[model samples]
Target: MSSSSEEIRLAAGTAEVGVQPGNGCRLGSLTVDGVELLRQGERYGSFPMVPWCGRTRDGRFRNGGTLHQLPVNSPPHAIHGTARDAAWKTARQSPTEAVFTYDLTDPWPYPGRVTQVVELTEDALTLRMAIETYGDSFPAQAGWHPWFNRHLAGGDGGQDDSGVQLSFTPAWQEQRGDDHLPTGTRVAPTPAPWDDCFGMPGGVDVTLTWPGRLELNVASREEWVVVYDEPADAVCVEPQTGPPNGLNTLPRLVTPLEPLETSTTWTWRRL
Candidate 1:
């Protein structure tokens, strides 16, 4: 359960990003001018999601004619895939960029490889991920789950929707059922407490601004992103290849020749 604390730090202007290669290739911290932007801890920062983005119904999925049952990490559902907590091998590294890779084995049913590349610039950070199977084609998804602090400058450390403002024009929302899985019905965007998925047919683009502080623009070419802001201390704007339970509902098959790739970028500036 312990990962190498060794960090690969990158800095550009007032922005600093820390990546832990051994710890699931997780981003430990993202600070802008000494102000921490990501929540700190096991469930914080940002982690890559591969094979699947969110959750699977009852931890079970029927691919082709075989029924695959994943371990129920979240009680009734299998969440976030196995990559988030898995240790990734550092394939390459530089002063401001790194590449991490993980091979998918048992339980997953498909033999595949997942690769994540992170690049840092003076004003932005870009993340790219892809999955490719060695054998037959299989369903998969890719995304990043970043838990951003509500108060960028370490205000009270309380979990309230204060200071930070979230804005996005979603084309539609996937109505969530009691199981926290999408009900296959798409509705219009509503208010807060949105642990739901939204469709950005135009592309995944969202804005987070802490008035008088800094403004962050999260843009991705992916068409789907989940915005979870019901928490007190932080908010999550997840950009994924598909919605939760998509493995069974909307599977994106990846073959040895065709890999599923997606990218997301976070650009920031002082406001």
Candidate 2:
């Protein structure tokens, strides 16, 4: 399944990862020793959020009782999902690991299938995603988004005080309303240029320090994690599995033998 772009490199010892199985199964970069934890182009690395993961309010959604219109493409709201922009299908690769596949046709009326795997070890970097359905029961969400790199690469000179340093302990904050979605009320974790949506519920752990150069540790068993650092260069840790219209508030259904999975793991060191 070509179409155009194709890169899939994965190393282990010095830790490198760049998989783009034609863009939707994106990553593009995640170096380690040479230090570049993501963020390098085409809107920056790490991308996957199948079936629906962010925004869909003005774009509409309502599976069982009808009402489905989506295509706002972030106009008033309809961001992220649609498999990053389609075109994925490698199904398997080697070196350090890879796998991509997509098949949820036409403006997305259901009849799903999405899989994305990425694995690089020796310091860790793992991502897995899944959503399956072929009949009935279908409402979904899955996540990943990662756009790290605020000045990675042995910092101390990249400025902005050497950039990257984000901690996480969220158990609240999701109150965003005013069209940016997420007003189910639950506030309290402020301080940053934060775009909002947090409620780790003990899942999605984050850390990304880069003071002496690297720290990275962004786990995720998924419980919603969207930390958009207001972008001065990059910082987007988005674990997501709901929160942002959440397909009309939080719907996760995907039946047809239970198929909805999520995973995120990015371990690191060297600081």
Look at candidate 2 and tell me the lDDT of residue 139. Answer: 83
Against the true structure, candidate 2 reaches a TM-score of 0.36
Best by lDDT: 1
Q: TM-score of the candidate numbered 1?
A: 0.95
Candidate 2 — what's its lDDT? 0.82
lDDT at position 269, candidate 2: 83
lDDT score for residue 70 of model 2? 81
Candidate 1 on 1-271: residue-level lDDT in tens?
Answer: 2356767787877778998867778899998878889999966799998779898899998779988899999989999998877777888788888888899987788898999898998889999998988898989889999999887664455433357899999999999999999999999888897898999989999999988778899999988999999988889999999999999999988988899999999999887
lDDT tens string, model 2, 1-271? 7454778888989998878767787887888776677888875788887788778788888988998888898888788888778778887789999888899887888887888889889898888888898888878788878888787643444444678889888889888978888778898888989888898877889898888767888888777898898877888988877887888878889999999888888898876
Pairs in clash, predicted candidate 1? 159-232, 159-233, 160-232
